[model samples]
Target: MELLERLFMGSPALWGGGVAHSVLILALVVALGIMLGKIRVAGVSLGVTGILFVGIAFGWYGMNVDGHLLHFLKEFGLILFVYSIGLQVGPGFFSSFRKGGVTLNKVAVLAVLLGVGTTVALYCLTGLPMTTLVGVMSGAVTNTPGLGAAQQAFSDLHAGAEAPDIATGYAVAYPLGVVGAILTLAALRYLLRVDTQREEREAGSGTDALKDLTTRRISVEVCNPAIEGMSIAQLRELALREFVISRICRAGGEPELAGADTKLHGGDRVLVVAAPRDIEALVALMGREAADTPLMRDRKMISRRILITKSELNGKQLADLKVRSTCGVTITRINRAGIDLVAAGSLQLQIGDRVTVVGPELSVAHAERLFGNSLRRLDHPNLIPIFIGIALGVVLGSISFWIPGVPQPVKLGLAGGPLVVAILIGRYGPHYKLVTYTTMSANLMLREVGIALFLAGVGLGAGEDFIPTLLAGGYVWIAYGAAITVVPLLLAGLWGRLRYKLNYYTLIGVLSGASTNPPALAYCSEQTQTDAPSVGYATVYPLSMFLRVLAAQLLILMFG
Candidate 1:
């Protein structure tokens, strides 16, 4: 340790090395970040590797010094990253909240509590010091973000103002964080084997509700035509008391959402949800030339269902089986590669294929009885709105960088400014595309590399003085890391069961931020039915992302 330390301290690299050692460390980390971004990932790899490289490189090639500047960058970068996350999550987050954010909150709170409690308890009992405690806490939460907060807390309490020896301490405890996270995930999946779709499955569909409840609908025609000349807001407000408009279809166009701001025209078909019998009564009042809202479209409604080619059902051509005759429904079209099938009797049904069916509303119910949860309708036209929202988010985030009053050299969040802006853009942007959901994957490796390098820088700069308590009290770190995993795993299991019996593997992903897995969710989603694994995944995943960034700093601060 002494020899290497001396050699790294600009002890001349046999040639003209001198001050170049420090520069080389920085370059290496930067190079690693570049390589990870360009070679490893196509996108979203920037923040992960870039941040990691910068973080770790500090420990390896840095000199122990007060890095006020670098500290500011780190702090600001993290905040920007967090703020962007908050913005992106804001829109749907509220929706999720209305549905059941309470359960999510409880689990998150428990996670942080487990981190803190484990550390404090272990510190008192094992005398493992605070640095390791921070690392353990970070590992348990799978929240790197909390690490910074915890570290700050520890430094304030024990080491006056000068931070602990972050080099050796961070290096040692980092492994613990990685290992601890891995173990907790493994244990949860092993014990619980959860799935969230069961309850939702029991909740009957809106179609059934439509049939059961007597619906009242009103229709109005306008010739004004702005987009047609009907004001969506006015029409909606006009009908607010009696009905909620469901959809509006123009001649030869996709149906527009009811509340869309298009003007009404003479032929525009407006569909409203209300009492089934009151249609004639409302129409009677507005008569003469105009009619009350009571017009049903004659076009056949499309049924949305997922059809997979299970080996048990292979080699059967559509014409041969007469699925319509046998199942009381007809296939509207098949969506194999793209384009829905309007006429596909001759097309053979292959394994792993999908089909869309349409038939009588009763036939749909009958089909379910025959096919089980195997078929459904592709009905939510609101998907377009999601994509629109995402685009807007990205624009907003990108423009923020160019905002007039914003600081020029500011680090937006994770990877300076631009990347943070991008994260927010995607996360917050209104129109969300499922394909673009993973758009950030390209920079994932870059972000990791940056963080590693930055850590190395910190380690190199802090040198060895960061470790006074560590030399004084050695066993504290082991206790801290050990307790982090134990407490969090217990809490996750308890919380998972209490909340919704969330699928075990997905819950692990939530707790640990292991989004890319060994086909856990996909396989499970296929096996059990319903995309319920994703609910558990998405519920806690956002928080986990922020936590992952902060956890790194906390480990360094507490254990260093």
Candidate 2:
């Protein structure tokens, strides 16, 4: 029993070691939480949120952890999480505001307003403390940033008495917030009698404009007499589609690399790289398809996906880079934000863009170095922009704007300030010579680590008092939070479906975005077996995150 307690609880001797036992406990909670999170019930999982539950259990068992250490880890984890998200979605954030973006954002904003209204109503009906309601509001929306922002606001207002209540309410409400969003999706499907197949078809067709570029390479014989004498540039203009003529082979000569000004001759074969649908038009304009000849299948030539990781290469035009002239490699296509774009001369390269370069193997290898294709480099976190962003966020969070008749000035707080700054940096970092890209593995690691630390901190802080509060009418906060989670989502989803005629998949995405619930988004994507939910989710996520944080802080300012 003594050994078991020492192993599980960590004795004072363990605590007095160079590394405190608290650190060990925190590590255990995080590792166990991650493993437990992978266990799904009916296709639903808590994901990284399991860390909170683990921490709660440990805290409830009287685990003594360092409070300052927990606080630092929590806030730092939150910064890393939000900053990574901002970078991941930054490039597309502004573009998502265009076209149907206004409508999508409006609907998303309305949904957030509905949640705030629901919170207010619950407050009036239950007479719950404002701090608890604010926490519930954050949890109900499944937005950890909002919760962090609200806590920051509480701290700013010197309301230390209610701080623990915020964590307690949030921890209690968060699980239902995730489940409630999924349930809202299910309820809407049943209530609206949506046809899954029909919705999928409509969503696919209606959102065709949102489709990523699909590229294909084909060899076409230039038998068309009219275009035979035309330059490669002229043929490209005539085709009226985006494609590149990478190489040309004459009737009895070697397959020579082709440039824009290279002239096409009748019976000559050309290698064309273009969008799948556009390939047909080019084929018809060029001539019949041909099998790969010996020259066309040159053994020395190769293709490789090279990541653009160097800060020096970012924001430079493809023509300016002169890889073909210097390294003998041609960039056929560029993959950015899950879309394939033709490597036009004028197209600028951004950090994280993967360019498919085709050339001699040695030349491609050289090009890889020029493009900074070091996996180790990607693994090393770029600390410059991260620390800069956090410093700026803290500064921004301190600035307050006074409004007439308001008791307190409105500030962006730690969460909002850093999030907004990260998004802007992510979008325009390349333009300003800032490298904001992180490898996918690194980004996910940072995000998971951050959320785990944050959740663990919150759980440890709330656990000691959680049981007593729950026994003393704290359970009502859970019911109130559930209502806050479901009512707004269902109302907005149904209204969007019936009135605006939104596709079911899209509506689900909007609900997920408005709630800022990644778990719900994951479920929606899995359930639909399509990426349609992602478009809607990405479209509203930035605005939804901003609004959620603002609303949480506002709720506290109004009712605290």
Clashing residue pair totals per candidate (backbone < 3 A): 139, 0
- lDDT of predicted model 1: 0.43
Give lDDT per model, in order: 0.43, 0.80
Report the lDDT tens digits of candidate 2 across residue range 243-294: 8877778998877667777898888988888765566678888888887674
Give me the candidate number with maximum lDDT.
2
RMSD of 2: 5.2
Q: In candidate 1, what residue range of length 10 has the lowest lDDT sum?
A: 203-212
Report the lDDT tens digits of candidate 1 across residue range 1-560: 86667544445543164445545545555565556534422211232334343434445345322355455544444433344344333323333332233455456546655666666677678665566555445533334444444444344445435444333344344444545555555566546654335434422121211111222334544444333454654654554433434445565565544433446665666654433333443343222123432334434443557454233334456667655556555554453322122223555554334665555566666654543333222221223323443344334423323333423311122322233344444333423322112112323333444344444444444444434445665435555565665566667656765665443433453454322222333343443343334444445455444444444433343344
- Which candidate number would show the highest TM-score if scored against the true structure? 2
